[model samples]
Target: MMRLERGSSRLYAMMLILAVVVLLADQLTKFWAVSTLSDSERIAVIPPLIHFRLLYNAGAAFSIGAGATWVFALAAAAAVIGILYTARRLASTGWALVLGVLLGGAVSHLGDRLFREPGFARGHVVDFIDYGPFVGNVADIALTCGCAAMLLLSLRGVPLAKTPEEETA
Candidate 1:
Protein backbone atom coordinates (compact mmCIF):
# COMPACT_ATOMS: atom_id res chain seq x y z
CA MET A 1 0.00 0.00 0.00
CA MET A 2 1.21 3.54 -0.76
CA ARG A 3 1.81 5.58 2.37
CA LEU A 4 0.34 9.05 2.51
CA GLU A 5 2.64 12.02 3.08
CA ARG A 6 2.06 14.22 6.12
CA GLY A 7 0.78 17.25 4.18
CA SER A 8 -1.57 15.10 2.14
CA SER A 9 -3.26 14.16 5.40
CA ARG A 10 -4.46 17.73 5.72
CA LEU A 11 -6.15 17.47 2.35
CA TYR A 12 -7.80 14.23 3.32
CA ALA A 13 -9.07 15.69 6.58
CA MET A 14 -10.45 18.84 4.96
CA MET A 15 -12.21 16.83 2.26
CA LEU A 16 -13.71 14.36 4.70
CA ILE A 17 -14.90 17.01 7.12
CA LEU A 18 -16.61 19.13 4.49
CA ALA A 19 -18.08 16.09 2.81
CA VAL A 20 -19.61 14.86 6.05
CA VAL A 21 -21.02 18.28 6.89
CA VAL A 22 -22.73 18.61 3.52
CA LEU A 23 -24.05 15.08 3.67
CA LEU A 24 -25.59 15.57 7.10
CA ALA A 25 -27.04 18.96 6.26
CA ASP A 26 -28.48 17.74 2.99
CA GLN A 27 -29.98 14.56 4.38
CA LEU A 28 -31.37 16.16 7.53
CA THR A 29 -32.95 19.02 5.60
CA LYS A 30 -34.41 16.55 3.18
CA PHE A 31 -35.88 14.60 6.06
CA TRP A 32 -37.40 17.80 7.40
CA ALA A 33 -38.87 18.57 4.00
CA VAL A 34 -40.52 15.18 3.65
CA SER A 35 -41.92 15.24 7.14
CA THR A 36 -43.22 18.79 7.16
CA LEU A 37 -44.23 19.93 3.68
CA SER A 38 -47.04 18.43 1.68
CA ASP A 39 -46.17 17.49 -1.87
CA SER A 40 -45.80 20.55 -4.05
CA GLU A 41 -46.66 22.76 -1.08
CA ARG A 42 -44.93 26.09 -0.78
CA ILE A 43 -44.30 27.99 2.44
CA ALA A 44 -43.07 31.43 1.62
CA VAL A 45 -40.09 32.68 3.55
CA ILE A 46 -40.03 35.82 1.43
CA PRO A 47 -42.95 36.61 -0.79
CA PRO A 48 -42.06 36.67 -4.46
CA LEU A 49 -38.63 35.37 -3.49
CA ILE A 50 -37.42 32.45 -1.41
CA HIS A 51 -39.80 29.77 -0.22
CA PHE A 52 -39.83 26.25 1.15
CA ARG A 53 -41.63 24.04 -1.33
CA LEU A 54 -41.44 20.30 -1.20
CA LEU A 55 -40.88 18.39 -4.38
CA TYR A 56 -39.57 15.02 -5.50
CA ASN A 57 -37.33 15.13 -8.55
CA ALA A 58 -36.65 11.98 -10.47
CA GLY A 59 -34.34 13.76 -12.82
CA ALA A 60 -31.60 16.38 -12.93
CA ALA A 61 -32.17 20.11 -12.58
CA PHE A 62 -35.45 21.41 -14.03
CA SER A 63 -36.57 17.81 -14.48
CA ILE A 64 -34.37 17.40 -17.49
CA GLY A 65 -34.32 13.87 -18.92
CA ALA A 66 -36.95 12.92 -16.38
CA GLY A 67 -36.77 9.28 -17.29
CA ALA A 68 -33.02 9.03 -16.69
CA THR A 69 -32.88 8.77 -12.95
CA TRP A 70 -30.59 5.79 -13.10
CA VAL A 71 -28.20 7.64 -15.39
CA PHE A 72 -27.92 10.45 -12.89
CA ALA A 73 -27.35 8.01 -10.08
CA LEU A 74 -24.49 6.52 -12.02
CA ALA A 75 -23.13 9.97 -12.74
CA ALA A 76 -23.14 10.78 -9.06
CA ALA A 77 -21.33 7.57 -8.33
CA ALA A 78 -18.71 8.42 -10.93
CA ALA A 79 -18.22 11.81 -9.34
CA VAL A 80 -17.57 10.22 -5.98
CA ILE A 81 -15.03 7.90 -7.51
CA GLY A 82 -13.28 10.68 -9.38
CA ILE A 83 -13.01 12.86 -6.30
CA LEU A 84 -11.49 10.05 -4.26
CA TYR A 85 -9.04 9.26 -7.04
CA THR A 86 -7.80 12.87 -7.20
CA ALA A 87 -8.15 14.01 -3.62
CA ARG A 88 -4.66 12.91 -2.56
CA ARG A 89 -3.09 15.30 -5.02
CA LEU A 90 -4.97 18.34 -3.72
CA ALA A 91 -2.17 20.46 -2.23
CA SER A 92 -3.94 23.75 -1.72
CA THR A 93 -6.56 24.38 0.98
CA GLY A 94 -8.77 26.06 -1.59
CA TRP A 95 -8.65 23.04 -3.85
CA ALA A 96 -9.41 20.74 -0.98
CA LEU A 97 -12.43 22.77 0.12
CA VAL A 98 -13.82 23.02 -3.41
CA LEU A 99 -13.48 19.35 -4.11
CA GLY A 100 -14.85 18.49 -0.69
CA VAL A 101 -18.09 20.32 -1.36
CA LEU A 102 -18.39 18.66 -4.74
CA LEU A 103 -17.80 15.25 -3.24
CA GLY A 104 -20.30 15.82 -0.44
CA GLY A 105 -23.06 17.05 -2.71
CA ALA A 106 -22.54 14.14 -5.03
CA VAL A 107 -22.64 11.63 -2.19
CA SER A 108 -25.71 13.18 -0.57
CA HIS A 109 -27.78 13.05 -3.75
CA LEU A 110 -26.47 9.58 -4.52
CA GLY A 111 -27.83 8.42 -1.18
CA ASP A 112 -31.28 9.68 -2.01
CA ARG A 113 -31.12 8.14 -5.46
CA LEU A 114 -29.97 4.83 -4.09
CA PHE A 115 -32.22 4.48 -1.06
CA ARG A 116 -35.11 6.93 -0.90
CA GLU A 117 -38.26 5.94 -2.83
CA PRO A 118 -39.48 4.31 -6.01
CA GLY A 119 -36.80 1.66 -5.59
CA PHE A 120 -32.99 1.68 -5.86
CA ALA A 121 -31.25 3.89 -8.43
CA ARG A 122 -34.68 5.18 -9.43
CA GLY A 123 -35.49 7.02 -6.23
CA HIS A 124 -36.39 10.68 -6.35
CA VAL A 125 -34.50 13.41 -4.55
CA VAL A 126 -36.44 15.41 -1.98
CA ASP A 127 -36.04 19.12 -2.58
CA PHE A 128 -37.67 21.95 -0.64
CA ILE A 129 -35.83 25.23 -0.92
CA ASP A 130 -37.47 27.29 -3.64
CA TYR A 131 -36.13 30.38 -5.28
CA GLY A 132 -38.96 31.41 -7.53
CA PRO A 133 -39.13 28.83 -10.33
CA PHE A 134 -35.90 27.15 -9.27
CA VAL A 135 -36.12 24.67 -6.42
CA GLY A 136 -33.23 22.68 -4.94
CA ASN A 137 -31.64 21.20 -1.83
CA VAL A 138 -28.49 21.83 0.15
CA ALA A 139 -26.57 19.43 -2.07
CA ASP A 140 -27.37 21.47 -5.14
CA ILE A 141 -26.21 24.65 -3.43
CA ALA A 142 -23.01 23.03 -2.30
CA LEU A 143 -22.36 21.68 -5.76
CA THR A 144 -22.92 25.11 -7.24
CA CYS A 145 -20.63 26.77 -4.75
CA GLY A 146 -18.00 24.14 -5.35
CA CYS A 147 -18.11 24.70 -9.09
CA ALA A 148 -17.83 28.45 -8.57
CA ALA A 149 -14.86 27.95 -6.32
CA MET A 150 -13.19 25.79 -8.93
CA LEU A 151 -13.59 28.59 -11.43
CA LEU A 152 -11.97 31.08 -9.09
CA LEU A 153 -9.19 28.69 -8.20
CA SER A 154 -8.48 27.96 -11.83
CA LEU A 155 -8.33 31.66 -12.68
CA ARG A 156 -5.91 32.12 -9.83
CA GLY A 157 -3.74 29.25 -11.14
CA VAL A 158 -4.73 26.45 -8.80
CA PRO A 159 -1.41 24.95 -7.78
CA LEU A 160 0.01 21.82 -9.34
CA ALA A 161 2.98 20.28 -7.62
CA LYS A 162 5.97 20.28 -9.94
CA THR A 163 6.40 17.09 -11.90
CA PRO A 164 9.83 15.43 -11.90
CA GLU A 165 10.43 16.55 -15.48
CA GLU A 166 9.38 20.13 -14.76
CA GLU A 167 11.44 20.18 -11.57
CA THR A 168 14.49 19.01 -13.51
CA ALA A 169 13.96 21.84 -16.05
Candidate 2:
Protein backbone atom coordinates (compact mmCIF):
# COMPACT_ATOMS: atom_id res chain seq x y z
CA MET A 1 0.00 0.00 0.00
CA MET A 2 1.32 3.44 -0.82
CA ARG A 3 1.62 5.68 2.22
CA LEU A 4 -0.32 8.89 1.87
CA GLU A 5 0.20 11.96 3.99
CA ARG A 6 -2.57 13.05 6.25
CA GLY A 7 -5.02 15.48 4.59
CA SER A 8 -3.24 15.01 1.30
CA SER A 9 -3.40 18.17 -0.81
CA ARG A 10 -2.90 16.34 -4.11
CA LEU A 11 -5.79 13.97 -3.48
CA TYR A 12 -8.11 16.84 -2.70
CA ALA A 13 -7.13 18.66 -5.89
CA MET A 14 -7.70 15.57 -7.97
CA MET A 15 -11.07 14.99 -6.35
CA LEU A 16 -12.16 18.57 -7.04
CA ILE A 17 -11.28 18.29 -10.71
CA LEU A 18 -13.07 14.97 -11.04
CA ALA A 19 -16.17 16.35 -9.36
CA VAL A 20 -16.30 19.38 -11.68
CA VAL A 21 -15.85 17.24 -14.75
CA VAL A 22 -18.64 14.85 -13.79
CA LEU A 23 -21.07 17.66 -13.00
CA LEU A 24 -20.35 19.56 -16.20
CA ALA A 25 -20.53 16.50 -18.36
CA ASP A 26 -23.83 15.40 -16.86
CA GLN A 27 -25.50 18.78 -17.32
CA LEU A 28 -24.04 19.33 -20.76
CA THR A 29 -25.22 15.98 -21.99
CA LYS A 30 -28.68 16.63 -20.64
CA PHE A 31 -28.73 19.95 -22.46
CA TRP A 32 -27.67 18.26 -25.65
CA ALA A 33 -30.33 15.60 -25.24
CA VAL A 34 -33.05 18.19 -24.73
CA SER A 35 -31.94 20.23 -27.74
CA THR A 36 -31.44 17.31 -30.08
CA LEU A 37 -33.85 14.54 -29.18
CA SER A 38 -37.59 14.46 -28.88
CA ASP A 39 -39.15 12.88 -25.83
CA SER A 40 -39.24 9.05 -26.00
CA GLU A 41 -37.42 9.06 -29.34
CA ARG A 42 -34.61 6.61 -29.77
CA ILE A 43 -31.65 6.63 -32.13
CA ALA A 44 -29.68 3.45 -32.13
CA VAL A 45 -25.95 4.03 -31.86
CA ILE A 46 -24.99 0.38 -31.77
CA PRO A 47 -27.16 -2.57 -32.52
CA PRO A 48 -28.30 -4.38 -29.40
CA LEU A 49 -25.77 -2.45 -27.31
CA ILE A 50 -26.32 1.27 -27.10
CA HIS A 51 -28.73 3.98 -28.20
CA PHE A 52 -29.62 7.59 -27.57
CA ARG A 53 -33.04 8.49 -26.24
CA LEU A 54 -34.76 11.23 -24.29
CA LEU A 55 -36.75 10.57 -21.15
CA TYR A 56 -38.01 12.65 -18.29
CA ASN A 57 -37.95 10.86 -14.96
CA ALA A 58 -39.90 12.44 -12.13
CA GLY A 59 -39.09 9.63 -9.79
CA ALA A 60 -36.23 7.70 -8.29
CA ALA A 61 -34.50 4.70 -9.83
CA PHE A 62 -36.68 2.55 -12.06
CA SER A 63 -39.40 5.13 -11.54
CA ILE A 64 -39.86 4.22 -7.91
CA GLY A 65 -41.80 6.71 -5.75
CA ALA A 66 -43.02 8.15 -9.00
CA GLY A 67 -45.00 10.92 -7.36
CA ALA A 68 -42.44 11.99 -4.82
CA THR A 69 -40.09 14.06 -6.90
CA TRP A 70 -39.75 16.73 -4.27
CA VAL A 71 -38.90 14.14 -1.65
CA PHE A 72 -36.14 12.78 -3.85
CA ALA A 73 -34.82 16.27 -4.40
CA LEU A 74 -34.61 16.87 -0.68
CA ALA A 75 -32.93 13.52 -0.14
CA ALA A 76 -30.35 14.25 -2.82
CA ALA A 77 -29.57 17.62 -1.30
CA ALA A 78 -29.02 16.02 2.08
CA ALA A 79 -26.77 13.36 0.60
CA VAL A 80 -24.56 15.98 -1.03
CA ILE A 81 -24.15 17.78 2.23
CA GLY A 82 -23.39 14.54 4.06
CA ILE A 83 -20.75 13.53 1.56
CA LEU A 84 -18.98 16.87 1.90
CA TYR A 85 -19.04 16.57 5.64
CA THR A 86 -17.33 13.17 5.47
CA ALA A 87 -14.77 14.26 2.89
CA ARG A 88 -12.52 15.73 5.54
CA ARG A 89 -11.83 12.19 6.76
CA LEU A 90 -11.04 10.93 3.26
CA ALA A 91 -7.69 9.18 2.97
CA SER A 92 -7.51 6.74 0.09
CA THR A 93 -7.18 7.71 -3.56
CA GLY A 94 -9.91 5.24 -4.41
CA TRP A 95 -12.22 6.72 -1.83
CA ALA A 96 -11.54 10.24 -3.02
CA LEU A 97 -12.42 9.47 -6.62
CA VAL A 98 -15.55 7.53 -5.72
CA LEU A 99 -16.76 10.19 -3.30
CA GLY A 100 -16.04 12.94 -5.80
CA VAL A 101 -18.11 11.31 -8.49
CA LEU A 102 -20.83 10.51 -5.98
CA LEU A 103 -20.93 14.11 -4.86
CA GLY A 104 -21.03 15.41 -8.44
CA GLY A 105 -23.78 13.01 -9.44
CA ALA A 106 -25.86 13.85 -6.41
CA VAL A 107 -25.45 17.56 -6.93
CA SER A 108 -26.20 17.32 -10.64
CA HIS A 109 -29.42 15.46 -10.02
CA LEU A 110 -30.26 17.93 -7.31
CA GLY A 111 -29.86 20.72 -9.86
CA ASP A 112 -32.28 19.04 -12.23
CA ARG A 113 -34.68 18.42 -9.38
CA LEU A 114 -34.54 22.06 -8.39
CA PHE A 115 -34.48 23.78 -11.80
CA ARG A 116 -35.61 21.55 -14.62
CA GLU A 117 -39.15 21.73 -15.79
CA PRO A 118 -42.76 21.14 -14.73
CA GLY A 119 -42.28 22.96 -11.37
CA PHE A 120 -39.72 23.93 -8.75
CA ALA A 121 -38.46 21.17 -6.44
CA ARG A 122 -40.48 18.68 -8.43
CA GLY A 123 -38.79 18.91 -11.79
CA HIS A 124 -38.07 15.77 -13.71
CA VAL A 125 -34.54 14.68 -14.47
CA VAL A 126 -33.52 14.56 -18.12
CA ASP A 127 -32.27 11.11 -19.00
CA PHE A 128 -30.76 9.74 -22.18
CA ILE A 129 -28.36 7.01 -23.25
CA ASP A 130 -29.94 3.59 -23.38
CA TYR A 131 -28.42 0.15 -23.07
CA GLY A 132 -30.99 -2.28 -24.28
CA PRO A 133 -33.74 -1.87 -21.68
CA PHE A 134 -31.72 0.25 -19.28
CA VAL A 135 -31.84 4.01 -19.77
CA GLY A 136 -29.77 6.44 -17.77
CA ASN A 137 -27.89 9.74 -17.98
CA VAL A 138 -24.29 10.70 -17.32
CA ALA A 139 -24.98 11.50 -13.69
CA ASP A 140 -26.63 8.17 -13.13
CA ILE A 141 -23.76 6.38 -14.76
CA ALA A 142 -21.24 8.24 -12.64
CA LEU A 143 -23.18 7.62 -9.46
CA THR A 144 -23.59 3.93 -10.17
CA CYS A 145 -19.96 3.40 -11.01
CA GLY A 146 -18.82 5.40 -8.01
CA CYS A 147 -21.00 3.44 -5.65
CA ALA A 148 -19.73 0.18 -7.10
CA ALA A 149 -16.15 1.34 -6.63
CA MET A 150 -16.83 2.26 -3.03
CA LEU A 151 -18.35 -1.13 -2.40
CA LEU A 152 -15.35 -2.87 -3.90
CA LEU A 153 -12.97 -0.73 -1.91
CA SER A 154 -14.81 -1.56 1.26
CA LEU A 155 -14.69 -5.24 0.45
CA ARG A 156 -10.93 -4.94 0.01
CA GLY A 157 -10.60 -3.29 3.42
CA VAL A 158 -9.65 0.16 2.28
CA PRO A 159 -9.86 2.50 5.23
CA LEU A 160 -11.64 5.82 4.79
CA ALA A 161 -10.51 7.40 8.02
CA LYS A 162 -7.87 10.09 8.36
CA THR A 163 -4.33 9.29 9.46
CA PRO A 164 -2.94 9.82 12.96
CA GLU A 165 -1.47 13.17 11.94
CA GLU A 166 -4.84 14.30 10.71
CA GLU A 167 -6.48 13.10 13.89
CA THR A 168 -4.13 15.29 15.89
CA ALA A 169 -4.86 18.26 13.66
lDDT of each: 0.87, 0.87
lDDT for model 2 comes to 0.87
Q: After superposition, how far is residue 21 of candidate 2 from its true place, in Å?
A: 0.5
Candidate 2 residue lDDT tens string, 72-121:
99999999988776666678899889988998899999999999888899
The top-ranked prediction according to TM-score is: 1
> Which TM-score value belongs to model 1?
0.93
Give stretches of model 1 more than 4 Å off.
160-169
lDDT, candidate 1, residue 132?
83
TM-scores for every predicted model: 0.93, 0.90
